[model samples]
Target: MNPDIYKLLIIDDHPIVAEGIAAIASRQKNITCKSITCLKDLLSVIASEQFDMCITDLEFPDTNGFQFIHILQDKLPSCKILIYTMHEEPWVIARLSELNISGAVSKHTDTSELSTAITSIRMGNKYFSEVFATLNKRKSTTEGHKIPELSKREKEVLSYLAEGLSTSQIAALLCLSSNTIQTYRKRLMEKLNAKNVAELVSKGKEIF
Candidate 1:
């Protein structure tokens, strides 16, 4: 859309997925890409370069997806974030809202939709693919209540935050805000009555 070229960084634990996104981005006009498949490498790569947008997977072998997003945003505040994940649950949608990510698309989403998402973020707009939109719609119908049983999204965020990802990184993966994630943290603490992050971690491990 804009005349300026966009630089993209992709963080996925899978080599195939990273390569696929890189290939697609390379073929697209006005865009360039760099991809990383490990958290250590991902951090180092971002530190060494600047990017206009970041497309990341939600889960990784070394770190939680949402936490990783938080880390990337903190390390590179100006970079727009796009979540490409297989998670399609309603709570996942709500979690993304909390993180305030720029865009979200399912791994199952077609290339056209993926292109549209990248374009939207590059143009300074947020995009949520149909799969994401549907999840949010379903979540809204359930109101803002959390089941006494923690949902997978909450557990993931909690476990990761406990593992040391800053709230900002968690926000990025969950497509939410650091503050919003803080809310989740506070609520989780209150629910578990853990009183602190360490206790929360212990509880998280017990639950999972």
Candidate 2:
């Protein structure tokens, strides 16, 4: 591969969707694209290869798409992730920066925009549709309630939780037992008044 060319991986459960993006995105200068149908296939590829970007959809049936994005970020820390999904909820938009995602474009956008997004991210800039900015603004305005201050330990837990680590994974990373991680998660949830992980990350990302 040419050093000047960027490689983008399209990950959508539907082979056709992935291929369509790959085909269109491949036309851009200094860019190439390959598509995968599922995360399992991606795991197989990740062990031996890396790419410039991973374009993913958030509606996988067999996996929670947010968690999957976290996994991709973990596995490919240098690769920018571009969400190419139909989901545009406020929670999703606010959590994008929290998750360290580099860029995003709604699937409903023109196919040419995909090329534009890829080009922008390849140049080390981010590309999100107006929808994300609008949603993020709304989240900041309407969900302006503040939470209590957290201890240093609680803040640590929230950061890892935002990264999408499971209880056991966080425990192992923190060198504590799983039970301790669970306790921290519980306390973080209570502090934030979050009923679930999604809510926890969404609210906590703003604070962190």
Per-candidate RMSD, Å: 10.1, 9.9
lDDT of 2 by residue, 109-162 (tens): 788888888888888899887787677677678754233467788788888888
Worst 10 residues of 2 by lDDT: 140-149
Which structure among the candidates has the greatest TM-score?
1
- TM-score on alpha carbons, each prediction: 0.69, 0.67
The backbone clash count of each candidate, in order, is 17, 0
Model 1: residues >4 Å from true position, as ranges? 1-4, 148-208
Question: To one decimal, what is the Cα RMSD in angstroms of model 1 from the true structure?
Answer: 10.1
lDDT of 2: 0.77
Candidate 2 stretches with Cα past 4 Å from truth are: 144-208
